[model samples]
Target chain A: MIELHRVSKVYSVGPVKVPALREVSFRIGKGEFVVLTGASGAGKTTLLRLLYRDDLPSEGDVEVLGYGLVQMRRSQVAAFRRSIGVVFQDAKLLPVRTVYENVAFVLRVLGTPRRDITARAFDALRAVGLSARAQAYPAQLSQGEAQRAALARAIVRRPPLLLADEPTGNLDEAMAGEIVDVLKDIGAGGTTIVLATHQARLAVALRRRTLTLEGGRIVKDEG
Target chain B: MLGFLVGEALRDLRRAGRVAVSAVVLITLSLAALGGFWLVSSNLGHAVAKWRDRVRIVVYLKREPPGGDVAALLERVRVMPGVAGVVFIGKADALRALKQVLGKDAGVVDQLPVNPLPASLEVTPSAAAVTPEGARELLARLAVLPEADDVAGSADWVERFSHWQRLLTTIGLGVGFVLAAASILTVTTATTLILHARRHETEIMRLVGASEWTIRLPVLLQGMMQGLAGAILALGALVVTHSVVAPRLEPLVSLTLGLSQLVFFTPVGVVALLGAGTLLGGLGGWLARAAREP
Candidate 1:
């Protein structure tokens, strides 16, 4: 679950003020698949970032999974992060680690038991249809395959919340459709999914509860 | 859990082997610097101990006691403190020894036909009077004696040698400081590189819900490993250096300098050196992690 009440985020670059979110108010319910749509500089990324406690809101309050984002300590951030899966626009897999290790990286970071990390990592790889290529490096995989690996890493912990920032930005149209379909399957399996994007065609196809943003303010919230 | 920590550490080391190597190099340089200081101080101590075996003081004899009453004069020299096994070396013996050293140079021997060398009493000082300054002060007391010409042994040469040794020690300290500073800088730079290369990996780990402790343990272990490896290398270098140099200096000044008695690291000493290396490496890693804003 995600909630924001009159939240605003502003950035100051040498006294030149830039606002990313202007008193935004929204709520994303548990098990709901939501698509956040906006053009560049529309504050979509800032909203998603607030969910994981990455970027704190400048005004008002934001809460995710019942924890106040602004109030959470650094130690608490780790626990919060462990409860959600995130897919950044870049995939951001460790270049030195193999695909399996990258997925296992999160589990290991959480201090998961060795036996469980290996078993779970294998299962997650299989879920992404990457079982055969688990040992491959990120550089060795196709763009779609790497994205799928990233997807496996996100869901490996089985967090109730999943956020993807422009997950299909670098993929072909067909690949984007497939990625969306995969996310739909995850949402069906009871994971709350919040996907952010700029492409109207990709957004239209998801056919989920949608929130549209223009400039720094939300213009529409439609189911 | 220990294995898991070690595994994580090894993975980080393997991933960033070059950075790890650089850190180790820094650790080793520091170890070597401190080790060198210990080696010099200990070697000097050993040499001084050996010199103590031949510790002696020279007391010039009175003018043969005009009455030829040699008994009282020699007796007085014997009663003085630290007169261990005093032996009288008359002018005749002194002349013979001097001739042997200078080689029978005719003109020089003719010029000293009257035998300018004085009859002297060689007194072995107590171990308490082993320091050059100690010997000099005692000799000065002996010289003012109305009966004697001048005290000779354990004089200027000892003081000069000690001064040179102290100068060397000061230089050694300066060198050690430079080496330590260089090492700290090197370790800091290397750690920065390690952090940089893994920045993305760190971001990924954050995404996956890994705890900070889990992510940090490996980096700590890697730093500790680098330090240990560097220390071990330095130890090997010292051992090899001692082994090679000890033999060459044996016959040259073994008696006076006692180079053979120059002992290298004992087990405890080696451990101390290794521990120092580990601490520096571990601390460097800790600083790097602590300074990270992420």
Candidate 2:
């Protein structure tokens, strides 16, 4: 579940104030798949960042998965983040780690028991169809495979909410379609998903609830 | 979790490469300098203790005590506050001692026109009176004796040797502190480099919900490892230097300081040095984390 009420974000770049979002209000219910579509510099990334508590809203409230983003302590941020999954545009996998290690890294960090980590990590990898490439390093993977590995890492702990920011930004149509299908499959399993992408056609093709942004304002919200 | 941290620390150290090595070398140089000075000071302390037990004040008499009066004089000086005992050395006995000291040159002492040696009472001071101040006080008391001509105590030279020992300690500490500061800085720089090298990995870790301690501890451990390695190497160098150099210096030490052997650091001292290195390294790493984040 995600809720943002009258959220406004202004970034300061040396005496100049750049407003990235203005009075945005939205409520996303449980188990909903919402696509966030916008042009470059239209604040899609900023909005997702707020949802995950990476950046606090400048002048409003952001409540994601029961955490009040503006009021959460810095120490509590990590725990809150662990309760949700986030996939960036770039896969951002550790270059030296194998795909399996990358996915298992999250479980290891959370201090999951050794016996449970293997099964859980492999399950997540299988869910993203990256089980066959588990042994490959990030450098060895294709762009699409890297993104799939990132998805596996995100969902490894089976968080209730998943946020993807441009998960298919660099892929071709067929590869992008493959990633979108995987996300759809994940959504079908009852995980609340908020995905940000610049591709409008992709948003229309998915036929999910979509929030369209133009120049830091949500211009349209429709299914 | 501990094993994972140690593994990450070692990996970071390897990633730091030459900067890490330089930090270790700097710590080694600093610790070695400190240990070397400590060795010298410890030996000097032993020599000071040895000689303090043997300190004697000699009161040269204006004239030889009349035969029957010698006993009275000895008894009188014996009861003085710090006088442990008194030995009366007559002129003839003094001449004989001089000839004994002359060894093969005994004929030179016999060639003198008259017995040039003065009769004296050798006063052995108690342990409490062996210090420079105590000896000076005792000498002052004896100088006022009616039969005393010249009074001298061995405390002055012993005090000089003690001064030299303290100076060595102070100098050693000064040098060690400067080198230690440099080593800590070098460790900080090395850790900073590793942090930059692993920035992407760290960001990913943070995003994945790794706690600040989890993200920062490896860097701290890396610094400590560097420090620990340097300390071990420094101790090794010290041991080799001591074994190879102690025997060659013992004869001179025995002649000058009256010590039969040079003493290296005690076990406690060794641990202190190692602990200092580790602490310095840890501090550097902690500072790096503070600077990087804050």
Candidate 3:
């Protein structure tokens, strides 16, 4: 579903050049559950960001869901974004909007029909087992509930690709397992999932492809 | 999308009700500055026009008519810039005009052994001819004539009218400068506030494939609304004040010129004020978005 060819990212902060990813080439087929693992600056987030076009590769080409991301205009970036569901580690919900509204934000931005938006938002909430808390505020939800709400928001559009950056990084073991289960259920439904994690045991049960990085280069690829 | 923007704007206004009120108050005050000066300028124009219509300039011929020079002199003064048209009131015509004005006192005019008044060149200049500056120039040129006497007219009347116009002109310019400054300040504040409220949302919206106008229209619309509301509020207060006080002032100055004569902005004026106010609001939003958009 996503591919990178000789992609490299360089960040110029002050006069110094910091290289995040260097000549990385990889691909994950459709419906695959992949964990990208690395130490602090091993370019895991940079790879994820490149896939989303949040940050472009400084060199070579990157493709996401068949779109030639290098040639994609800024105007078309949002359309590319809509093709994927992204669950952030932070669960960045608008504090002023309600739980349902947070999930509905993407649809509203897309100018989806009002009735469709409400139905999809409700269904997404139900899928995440949060329909009862649909009207509640972010402040009212526990960490697990908030992450669940974030999941609902990410999947509300039924996007083909799901990218979660540290989906369970902030949760306890039980909560982490819950998030993993939710993500797995999504992957089972044919959405290609690429989750970024450093945990040793989290990606073991899934038995899917794993790409391990070290020193800005992929060191291990296991299936 | 419009509904969403309007809803968001209203919600923002509600959440930051104080800021919205401050925006309106600032905008209203700015408009009041413009409206008040406009009213004053309009009234001044009317007063000048009224004074101009009734006023006439008198050009007196020299004491020695140099035999046949009387008609030529009359012709010269008749063609002067401020001179609308001229009437050659010969000695006999002058006596007749005096008799008419004097009415029953016409007998006293006939008692005079000779016509003491000069065979004056009665020049009726346009209202534009009634200014101190214009009149001064006309008199200076007229006096240089060999047949001329010391030129004179209602200097006080011209002076008074011109004085008011100059004062009003200064105030109009000063008010205009103030209004422009206020517009920029208001637009900057409004646009910045709009952007700040939706910075993250805007980015996400863009990332999610929203168009430029889809994001910007709401901000511009909000600005337009702010301007409209402010102008309306200020004008409403002014109208109410006029209704209450103009009637009372009517007894004092019979020739009072005010909003009563205006018919309350003549629709076009109202539209312009509201349109301008709304534009100010929208412009603020546009500027904010535009600055970051490129």
Candidate 4:
């Protein structure tokens, strides 16, 4: 489902070329739930961004779901994105929109039929256990609820691949474990998942294949 | 999809709040100024058309045409280019017309030792010669006539009025353009603010596979809505002003311009104003989006 061959990304600040990812390489088959664990500046976010085509690697090839990330045209990027789901460290829900509206927003943008949108949105929200809090605004929801709402929004279209970046970063231990359980359920349903986090214990606890990165290079890959 | 876009646009406009309101106000003021000038120009155009038909040029002769030659001279003048018709007036007839014009003061004209009035030929120009340039050309031709002493045409005053109308239109266009530029800039600023305010929402939308059009169209629509609102308000202001002021100004207009009644913009003109406002607003929105995205 995904392959990155010697992908290297560099950021330029004046005269300095700061490498975010240096010769990083990985491959994962369909339906794999992979945990990308690393410290604060270990290039986890950069790798996910490259996979989602949000940023281009300065060198090497990155492919996801058969699309060559570097060669993809701008017009094709939106269509490619629709085939996958992405969640950020922050649950970027529109503050003014209710949780339900936030979830339904993705379907609306995809031009889903009016009749199907309610059913699909509700199903997604129900999957994330946010059905009861659907009408609550993001500001009113607890941090965990807001994150679940964001997850519902990401998965509403039933995209085959899901990428979550530090989704449980702000949650307590119990809340983080609950979110992982939800991610596990989603993965069990045959959606490929990549969850990035700085907490190594969470990756070990889940018993999933984990990739550890340090100084912009993947240092370990083991179950 | 269209409904969703419009909804998003409305939401953005609401979010823009005071900035949106200010943009609309600017548009309204600009359109109103332009529409006001158009209204005045329309009335002036009508007056010019009406007065053109009554334009007359009088060619005073050095002396009365000798005996039977008066009819021959009248026929000659009538056949000249742009001459619609000609009437020969003898000195006696000129004096009689003067006495009638002087009304109760006719006794003063009777007290003169002799009629000081010159016999003249009244020349009515055809439609082709009604224009200031056309009248001047015809006047030059008549002035060179063998028996012509002095030639005077009513075209001069009409020409002056036409000049004023043209000047007003030019000034109106200049002012309207400046105001339109200002409105567009205001709209751009307003849309930019909304874009910044919704940055997080936009990022989420993009990540969720929203198309570029889906992400950007709301900003454009917000600007367009502002323009549309401004256009409607401008039209309303113009109608109210015309209704309240036209009647009071009609008498003066009639006395000066000889127009029987004042007229407002035609249906086409109203549509044009609305279209212009919407286009201006849309342009502003498009610019803002382009600047941000590009």
Q: Return the lDDT, model 3, position B254.
A: 47
Kindly indicate the candidate among 1 and 3 with the higher lDDT.
Answer: 1
| Residue lDDT tens for model 1, A1-223 | 7998999999999989899999899999899999999997898898889888888888989889889888888778877887888897788887878999988877777778888998999988887788899999999998888898999999999989999999998999988877887888888899999999998788888888899988879899987
Could you say which candidate leads in DockQ? Answer: 4
Q: What is the lDDT of residue A46 in candidate 4?
A: 94
Clashing pairs in 2: none
Residue clash pairs of candidate 4 = none
Ranking by TM-score: 4, 2, 3, 1
Off by over 4 Å in 3: B59-123, B126-163, B179-183, B186-194, B251-264, B286-294
lDDT of 2 at A177: 97
lDDT of 1 at A71: 85
Positional deviation of residue B252's Cα in model 3 after best superposition, in angstroms: 4.6
Give per-residue CA lDDT, model 1, range B114-147, as digits (tens).
8877787787766656567667666776787777
Stretches off by above 4 angstroms in model 2 are B60-121, B126-131, B146-150
TM-scores of chain B, in order: 0.71, 0.84, 0.73, 0.84
**Please, what are the lDDT tens digits per residue for candidate 2 over residues A1-223?**
7998999999999999999999999999999999999998999999999988788888999998888889999999888888889999999998988999988877876678888998999999999999999999999999999999999999998889999999999999999999999999999999999999999999999999999998888889998
Tell me each candidate's TM-score.
0.78, 0.90, 0.81, 0.90
For candidate 1 chain B, which ten residues in a row score worst on lDDT?
A: B62-71
The iRMS of model 3 comes to 2.0
Question: Evaluated on chain B only, what is the TM-score of candidate 1?
Answer: 0.71
Q: Where is model 3 chain A poorest over a 10-residue stretch in terms of lDDT? A: A199-208
10 residues in a row with least lDDT, candidate 4 chain A:
A105-114
